[model samples]
Target: MTYRLKYGTGTEAVHDAMPSIESEQLSLALAAACEDPIGATEVYGEDDGVMRTLVTEHAIAVLLVGRITKTVTVLQLSYTG
Candidate 1:
């Protein structure tokens, strides 16, 4: 099943403020995560499948993958480019 993507309270605003090209790259990365969360993201710290991160050329997204809910929630986003 495909996971639904959701942003944390202030994360959407952060995403909106990113440069357009970088934002698009992050969007595509998120979409890939939604389609295959485990395959697309790396474990943030531990090997736990839920806490993962998606990294793009310019940005890194911290995500919480909820297997029960089939959702990928963006907990934090950082733009480095």
Candidate 2:
């Protein structure tokens, strides 16, 4: 099932401040996560499947996947570009 994407408290602001290209790249990465949260991202720390990390060319995002809700919440975002 496809998941809904949501940004955590400060994640949206951080994403908004990034360069257009970088932001778009991150957006695409997040879109992929929405389609396949577990398949599109790597485990953040443990093999739990709920906490994940998505890496794009210019950013790394920490995400929390809610299986029951079918949502991918971006908890943190770091721009490297």
Of the candidates shown, which would achieve the greatest lDDT relative to the real structure?
1
TM-score of structure candidate 2:
0.96
RMSD of each: 0.6, 0.7
lDDT of 2 by residue, 19-59 (tens): 99999888988999999998999989998999999999889
**Across residues 1-81, which tens digit of lDDT does each residue of candidate 1 receive?**
899999999999999999899999999999999999999999899989999989999998899999999999999998887
Candidates' C-alpha lDDT: 0.94, 0.93
Cα error, residue 7 of model 1, in Å, equals 0.7
Off by over 4 Å in 1: none
Residue ranges of candidate 2 with Cα displaced over 4 Å: none
The clash count of every prediction, one per candidate, is 0, 0
